[model samples]
Target: MTLKIDCQLRDLDFTEVGTHAQKMEEMGFDAAWTFEAGQDAFTPLTLAAAATKNIHLGTNIAVAFGRSPFAMAQQAWDIQKLSRGRMHLGLGTQVRAHIERRFSMPFDHPARRISDYVRCMKAIFDNFQNGTKPDYKGEFYQFTLNNPLFSPGAIDHPDIPVYLAGVNPRMCRAAGEVADGFHAHPIHNMSYLKEVVLPAIDEGAKTRGKSVKDLHVQTMVLIAAGETQAEIDKAVEDVRMQISFYGSTPNYRGVLEHMGYGDLGKELSQMMRSGQMAEMPKKIPDAIVEQVAVIGKLSEVGPKVRERYEGVLDRVAYYYPIPKDAEIGNWKAFTDAVKHTA
Candidate 1:
């Protein structure tokens, strides 16, 4: 199977998205993804459409609870129209605290609710694309009205692919049942993907009478790589810090445990709760880092990534590019190696 290489933009700024997208496409990347943390995901992608062609654009995840289905559909549809069909709608049910406290939105039964949300949005999209009256009723959401004057009917791309990001089985299954893809969390290891996630997807697809092959599985993995040992060590430190920060969040304890670092996770969470943010990174041992990340000479990354995810993954995106200042040749070499092997 040919594994598609995908990459996400740095959260720092999006002013150079067009320039970056052109460069990424030239470097052989199949797609560009953006995340919504403190910024809007759709806007940067909309800007990217003005800059390049061919590379698919998507939100790695925009909060599902933050917007109504109608609003989400409207935004995704507009981007799809502008991109001439190169758009993917990725949704996430972020934790209840962020949804309720940060966004001031209601949150409950995320799996069921998001499943309902997807159905509602698809129903809305169908109504808009087919000029049919809207009448969808779900446990969590209902849409019974669509006025012709305000609705912009079908475009060239009416079926924008939908992907959902989640760490639990309920979400994996839900993605299989209703979404076109599953965006695996960066912290996930091969064991989790093969033992937990794949089974969930299979079960969900079987329940829905859908083929597992119909769902694209994409994962972003931690990387600590460079041309030289010094560069590799520096990148390793950065990834260690990031991994520790993630482990400190109790929500990810299961992932750490899957990597046989359960105690490390507990300690990190305790430190975080006690406001020892500076000490958290120091707690991540080298072994834990090695288990959760792919660290080696830059030349080894592509083959190792391919070895780790060859059968289970459809596409892979790195947590971040290594040797921040490395020449584009480094990235080109890495991607080319994977392509030739695949």
Candidate 2:
């Protein structure tokens, strides 16, 4: 079993990412993942690739709808070559609003679009490496690369792995059928993962005649560590606030409702729409917080995380939300404790 440690890019800057990637590599972590919500992940990833030599650098998820498949393949291939073959290109289809409204692009049939996008990317990489023209005609994308003048020329190809970010059943099955790995969201609980997500993956793999080992399962965990009770309370509140925001989204409401917190989802949704998001955490039920988060003492968090990985997850990515200047002693202590379990 390998233990991979990754922190969210939301809480870290470019300089911090390079420094932390080196530190995490020294700490025996297998990989470091960067995220993109509003900021571009490519710049920080390039810095991380330059700073670290061993640890794999990847995106927790780069939204596929924001960029074309050809451009994304070129960027991932360049990064893979630069990192000396230690790059994983993780992609996800975000909500329709981000695609249609924010980016001013078409958003239709996301499942099919993701499938076609992956095929197109892999075909482009293969064609570029073998010095052969790529002729692919999919429903969403069509490409014919036969011109030498526009080509980047024959280059050494690197093994670039693709992981899919999935939460629902159909997405999980799609990832299992085609993607190298499945990146699960942070709010999912162990029971839901074991009963819902893993079974779906297995079903899809069975249909495709692929072994379970061929599919990697990566999950995100929100973590905070502190000695005092008050500090721990603050950390828990921070996670609660994040969950509150996610619960309000229409796509994630079903997940919260499935966990027996449907009313809380409704309340949080109303609060978010009315511009009272900051106060919404105060109304979250304690049961829901305990079910979704790994809060409390270092000793307590280790076993809870281990429990989440018992039968389903292959890699666990911890999301650290503390400021750079803040004391990270407690955070380090928590990781040290969990290292034994891993």
Candidate 3:
């Protein structure tokens, strides 16, 4: 199994990002992905690209509705060039409320939108690489930039891989049909991944006359590693809180409900909607915590990560810093444990 060690950019500043990127590359990490929930994932990704020589730089997910596909294509192209062709463009359609209310953008037919977006991006990149004009006219986006002055000439391999973040079956299927890879949400368990997600992807691929081998399955796993049981308990609680925050959303509640935690899901939904943030974590049951994250000693964490990839996922992106720490000793331990497992 191929393991891809990665973390979010949340716990790292600019200087720390550079250092982490180099260190992660040295530690045999295949990729380094950053988050863009409230911050731009591109700036740090550029810094990571500059700092590392081989490790792939990417976003866990950059919101799609916030920017036009043209802009995304240009950014990905530029980053791929800057990184010497070591860039992965991961995109996701954030929740409807965030898109409609916060960004004032339409969020209709997300699966279809993502499919078109990927096709349009590929066409644009092909145009730049082949010195030809791309004529793309879809329901959502239409563009034809021929002989443009701002074109970045051509790239060696403009076919930079596109990864899609998906949780629902439709979105997962769309990822299989269009994207080069599929990124499962961190809250998902191994059972859901194997039973629900993988089958949907395979069905989608079959419809397109494709196969599972054509796509990569990448999952983000929250890992908290420590030597002592007290430290492990604290880390596990931190993961539980994070899972509570993610599970409180109505969309994610479905997954929790599927896991036979419908009552907890309803409670979390009520709390989140009422803005009772402080009381949210208290509702997350211990059983749900074990299902979501790998929280334990370094020895235990490695096996749990391996379990996720047993017969389903192709890569695991281990997110670090369950809490704040100046030194990445916990991350180092987790990676060392993963290597030992291999």
Best by TM-score: 1
Residue lDDT tens for model 1, 1-342: 788878785553567667777777666777888888778889888988778889888889888899999999999999999999999899999999999999899999898999999999999999889987788999999989979886878898798999999887888998888888899888877788888887888778886788668899998888888779999999898988898888887778888888787798889988989999888888887877777789898788889887787778898887783223446776787877766542
Estimate candidate 1's alpha-carbon lDDT, on a 0 to 1 scale. 0.84
Which rank order by TM-score, best down to worst?
Answer: 1, 3, 2
Checking candidate 1 for backbone clashes, the offending pairs are: none
lDDT of 2 by residue, 1-342 (tens): 634445554556666777876766655556778777767867778888889899888888888888988888878887888898888899999889889998787888887788888888888877767766679889898777556665555555456889888788888887877788889888877778887788877777777798556888888887654568888988888888888888887767667877887787778888888999879888777787787788866547766676556456777877774355544555454455555533
Residues forming the 10-long window of minimal summed lDDT in candidate 2: 321-330
Give the candidates in order of lDDT, highest first.
Answer: 1, 3, 2
**What C-alpha RMSD separates each model from the true structure?**
1.9, 2.5, 2.3
After aligning candidate 2 to the native by TM-score, how far in Å is the CA of 100 from where it should be? 1.1
Question: What's the TM-score of every candidate structure?
Answer: 0.94, 0.91, 0.92
What local lDDT does model 3 show for residue 230?
91
Model 2 earns a TM-score of 0.91
lDDT (C-alpha) at residue 174 in model 1: 89
List candidate 3 segments past 4 Å from native: 322-333, 339-342
Over 4 Å off, model 2: 146-157, 322-336, 339-342
Q: Best candidate per lDDT, number?
A: 1
Angstrom error of the Cα, residue 52, model 2: value is 0.6
